[model samples]
Target: MREDTKYALITGASGDIGREIAIALAKQGFHLYLHYNRNEKAIALLQEELVLFGVDVIPIQADFTNSDAISRLQDSVFQLDVFVHAAGNSYYGLFQDMPDQEIANLWDIHVHFPMQLLQKWIPKLQRSDAGRIIFISSIWGEVGAAMEVAYSAVKGAQIAFCKALAQEIAASGTTVNVVSPGMVDTKMNHLFDEEEKTALLTDIPMHRFAKPSEVGEVVAFLASDRASYMTGQTMRLDGGWFMR
Candidate 1:
């Protein structure tokens, strides 16, 4: 790797939103560490696509549910110029009916694993002149959702974590921010059919879902020198759903 080259590790890079964010960062001239849990095929294809941009792309597998994965991740990457935590799943069910294991998994994947990565990579990021940490948070983190109680809790934890960490690391020249998207058209919404989607659309002022590329572009910007002064902010990518 070239000494002048920059590295970005994006968790959940095989997913729709995370894939777009990886591509966008590749376009920004970043060598990428694409992290995916079990989707080797998807990560392979994404790695090929990212390589087209003339930047180094490496695919890594680590299940966030396992504590061992965090150790493996820490051993895999030495220095990180950018870190984007896009790894998480949505829980869509009644809170009372949810199992303890499900809630634990939600907190593990959404909070604990991310905290471990941030803690591990923060020092490496501090060494870079343009370090960036971005979390793909959700509108549920702010106003939250009805059936997504556990999901909302974890996402809310992520936002709070980013806010506090950003303040703590500001003088290190690293910027931390959250891109809390509203209703994005990703696999996470697969549970909702056209009818359900239509009903959900009624709540959004834009009457539509945001494209993955839209969120990706904002992430790219945040990772760039352009967003240097911006940190500790939750930039809602929601189409006026939870405007504050």
Candidate 2:
């Protein structure tokens, strides 16, 4: 990677949203460091696709559940122009029945590791002309759900983390923001039954789940020069599913 080519690191690059973000940023002339825990094949294919944009596609992997897993990533991120945290999971179960490990792992994935990596990227991000930090949060973070209590909790934490960190680093010219997307059409929502899916569809004013491409567009904008003034904002792409 050259010093002049702008760099963007996207976690969970094999995922629906992360993959779209990779493409979106690539289109914006960002050399990408695509991070994935598994699914090397998917990432390889995505890397192939992104190379058509004529930007560098560097695929890296790390287990988000482990604290020291992402330490090696420090060596790869030479210049981080944009940092996008899109790696996360959703737990669908009774809140009381949730195991302690489930909550801990969820928090580690959605909150801890992201903050850790962001801290490491702060210096490099500050050096870039366009420094942007974007987190792909959930609409459930805004409006709690009956079955997704733990998911909502960590997501709420992510939102709060973005707000606080935005202020802490505002003087550095780095813009931090969270993109809270509603029921996005992804494998993460495969657990829902036909009836439950129908019920969820009715709640969205648009009568449709959000597309990953739609969320990617917002993220790309925040990373672009036009959105330099935006920070600490939780922009929703939920189709009025959980309007504030």
**lDDT tens digits, residues 130-226, model 2?**
8999999988888878989999999999999999999999999999999999899999998898898899899889999999999899999999999
Each model's lDDT comes to: 0.91, 0.90
The Cα RMSD of model 1 versus the native structure comes to: 1.0
Q: List the residue pairs that clash in candidate 1.
A: none
Residue 3 lDDT in candidate 2: 70
Q: What is the C-alpha lDDT profile of model 1 across 114-183, one tens digit per residue? A: 8988887899999998999999989888987899999999999999999999999999989999999988
Question: Candidate 1: which stretches are off by over 4 Å?
Answer: none
Go through the candidates in order and give the clash count of each.
0, 0
Q: List the residue pairs that clash in candidate 2.
A: none
Worst 10 residues of 1 by lDDT: 235-244
